[model samples]
Target: MMAGMKFLSGKRSIFKVMGLICKKCALAIMVLALIAPFIATTQIILGDSKSDLEDAKKQQEDVQSKLEETKKYIEDLQGQVSDIQSYISSLDSQMETISSSLYELDLQVQDLEATIKTTEEELAKAEEDAKVQYEQMKLRIKFMYEHNDETYLGMLLNAEDMADLLSKAEYINQLSKYDREMLEKYKATIDYIAQTKADLEADKEELVNMQTNLQDQMSALSLLQSTKMTQLTNLNNTVAAEESYYSRLEAENEALEATTRQLEARIKAEEAAKSSVTSYDGGKFKWPTTSTRITSDYGDTDGRSAPHKGIDIGAVKVGVAGDPIYAAYDGKVVISTYSASAGNYIMIYHGDGLYTRYLHCSSLLVSVGDYVTKGQKIGLMGTTGNSTGVHLHFDVRLNGSYVSPWNYLSK
Candidate 1:
């Protein structure tokens, strides 16, 4: 009976040991199940953290690249501006030279005019003197003809002596010689006066031609100066726009870097806490304007010298101003201000690195940091800045690079 009790006690002890072992195994299994999930969650969080870090790093690189590119472009614009200024200065110098030449030419023309007037007076006097001398010569010739050779012969025959006849012949010969000499002298004077008048006229014609040429040159210079001035104005406007854009880009880069740092820190915290992450679904966006007709299509180079970066929506009455502009999606207003190139513009930041820009507005209805919903009125469309007509210039950006707005807008 004692041996039987010992056997039963030993069996009970074995059963207790098995039960303890089973309980330990179950506890280990439960712990393992919990630990496995924790490990998986940790892995997922780490993966998200890594991804966010990579995205931040990539964004930083992109910002740096854009900054470098903008700096280079600004330098290039500066050089162009300097060159244009120098060219304008050169043009000014040339105009000064032309002015000097024109002044001298005017003086020469005045002198020539004075000379011609004096010559004309001299010619008129010479003609009057010639006419009077001719009339006197003709009267003398008529007297000599009426007297004739018979009177000279009679005088010679009736002479008291040979000396008297010789004297009479000498008197007639002297009178005829005097009359011929006077007529020849008058004819020579008239010819000389005519030659002088012709020479003066020729000189005057040359001076007039020179004056006309100088005037033409002045006109050409004036036209060229006008063209250069216009070019300079355009260049100045472009520089102003580029400078504004550069400043905005710098601010954006700084903001992006700050956001990236914050994201990195947040990702680290999330990894430690194994927090949930939010994602964007990339939903379709609403049309930004009431008018559906596109005045300028995306990538169309019709009116633009380069590829158009965005689409332009015309007003309801076709080139009329003051149409309402709407937000394409729910977003926060990131920028709202006026620009020389974009006029009264607004930029919105939707989550997940998406952005939209509205340009050439006559008035703004929103401010920066204001939250806006899809189809909300944000501005009024009109021809401002670099626009030719009343329209809305709409743009979409993925990160900082421009993309087609059509990709996000509803058809």
Candidate 2:
């Protein structure tokens, strides 16, 4: 009877222990089921956040590219405008010269016309004098022919003495000689006047032709100036339109940047509130990308008016994208978002107010609130936002102020 009671008690105890173990297992399973949904929901939220961030980054990149192109076009237009203006100025100078030449030509033409008029008047006077002289010579010849010729010859023949005949002959000879000399002088004067008039007409014709040619040239220059003016106006209008577009793009970029900054701040605040602080190992940080080749050094000017804030790590080969970007140090992710200037980026918060940032990522491997380790891949390198090419931009900050990442990076 004692053995039987002992066996039953031991069996009862074993059953109770097994039942307790089964109950505990059921409770543990229930708890896991309850927590799994939350984890799934959190993952979904993070995924959505990443998607939104990516979209914003893509929009920003497109706008930035267009803005840059517009600015460049504006610059080109401005150069063309300057060239046109210079051409117009040159035309003005040419027109001034043409005008001066035209004025001189007019004076020359006027002077030539006056000279021709004077020559014509002189020719007319010479013609009249020749006509008058010819009339006088004709009258003298007629008188001699009708009366003196016959009568004087008869008287000469009728003269009985040699002295009388000689006297009559001398008189007739003098009269004839005078008439011939007067006729010759009138003929020479008429010929000279005709030649002078002809020469004057030829010179006047030449001057008129020259004036016509000058007028045609002036018309051509005027037409060219008009065409240039039209082109300049069109260029000015185009430049104005481009400038307006550029201004709109600039405003949009500023707004995007502002929104990104706000989102980052909000995310940082939320992460700080939710996450437990992580301590840095006080060791040197690892390189953030696969390649150690520095495309740009910290504090170096990146072709901007300002100095660069971070160092850029390029891929092994130029123009290659999709390289892994690793965390520089172990820390909790404080910000995983997109920015117009930084693109798809993440900020890790190491305790004691230290932080690190990665920029221009193509895709993110980690999310906000995630704890990352040094050398752990967090994203992929890309040419996002305002980036020029595929690379990783790494920065370090202490108390919100940027510092050189080189200070903590391993050699």
Candidate 3:
């Protein structure tokens, strides 16, 4: 009987121990319940990080699209860099914007990284706690399973009254619900962490691609700028040479005018003898150079002591040589010769006292007295005379006096 009484005493002790375990389990479940909302808040923050990354990508995409347009627009230069100053300014503007965008994006990425770091630490702690809570729950379940009958018997033996017994029973039932809920929460935390990690990695990769794309755009722009700079340098040199040419052009032109008048006297003598030019059909003169880009107009007097005598038509690419010079009208070549001031020149008489002269040819195609049709390729544009750059100096004379070529030019 004494041994039986000792056994009951031990059983009561076990009941007390089990009651303490149950209390600990309840505290763990309550802690999980409280922290559940915090984890949900963290999940929302993670979503916000994703949105910020996406927004940054969108901004870069916009800049990238504009760069593409710039790339295409730069291609329209067609071997010439004319009017390149304006385009260079445009490129500067675009680069400024791109630089600003990059700075802004970098700032945002830094902000996101800090935010993610803090949030990840919190999430990792929460996840570890949830795992611990789950482990505790499993241990409790195994203990209850191993001593299922004894656990309930201990509860009954330990209850002080009916109210207490019912309360303990209800508490045990609530623990099962806590177990299920805590398990779900733990799974959710793990999933959120995984998704956040994936998003971070993908965002990093996309940022790298954006950087590479920007580099390509910069390279293309640099190439275009280099080409334009070369053209600009050539143009500056040519302009200086042209200024020098104009300084001595007036004195040189006086003698040239005399000689040209003498040549015309001979041509008129031939026409009188029915040996040279036929009567003109009367039409606007053809543009004399393959390129209609005029470097100097007929009456351009800027930086010149006297008005420029003829239009100077340069190649499409400034300072480039070997482009064709064409005949202004159907005429007989009067004199095809080189002189100090008018190197490799041509004089054409288009009857009715109209005459066209081409100067600074690299090589003359027709001989003196050769009849040529209008728009014929008469020579290659060059800078052979009192000139220093490749171009054609075209003149129009009516009755031995220089006239405005613009008056006879169609365009």
- Highest TM-score against the true fold, candidate: 2
How do the residues 199-230 of candidate 3 rate in per-residue lDDT, one tens digit apiece? Answer: 87667667656666665555655655565566
Model 1: ten consecutive residues of lowest lDDT: 39-48
Each prediction's whole-model lDDT (CA): 0.70, 0.72, 0.67
What lDDT score is found at residue 403 in candidate 1? 87
Q: By the TM-score metric, which is better: model 1 or model 2? A: 2
Of candidates 2 and 1, the better by lDDT: 2
Q: Which candidate tops lDDT?
A: 2
- Against the hidden reference, what TM-scores do the models get? 0.52, 0.53, 0.40
lDDT of 1 by residue, 1-411 (tens): 332353355345435534543554465356445434432332111113346567656655655665676566657656755765775676577668767877887788788778878878877887787788778878877866898877778878988898988998898789778878877887787788778778877887887787676666567556655655665676567557657756755665675566556456544443332222132368898898888889888899985688888899889898788889999888777667665568788877776767788999999999766778889999999888878899999988675567888899994
Question: What local lDDT score does residue 172 receive in model 2, on the 0 to 100 scale?
Answer: 78
Q: Given candidate 3, what's the lDDT at residue 406?
A: 88
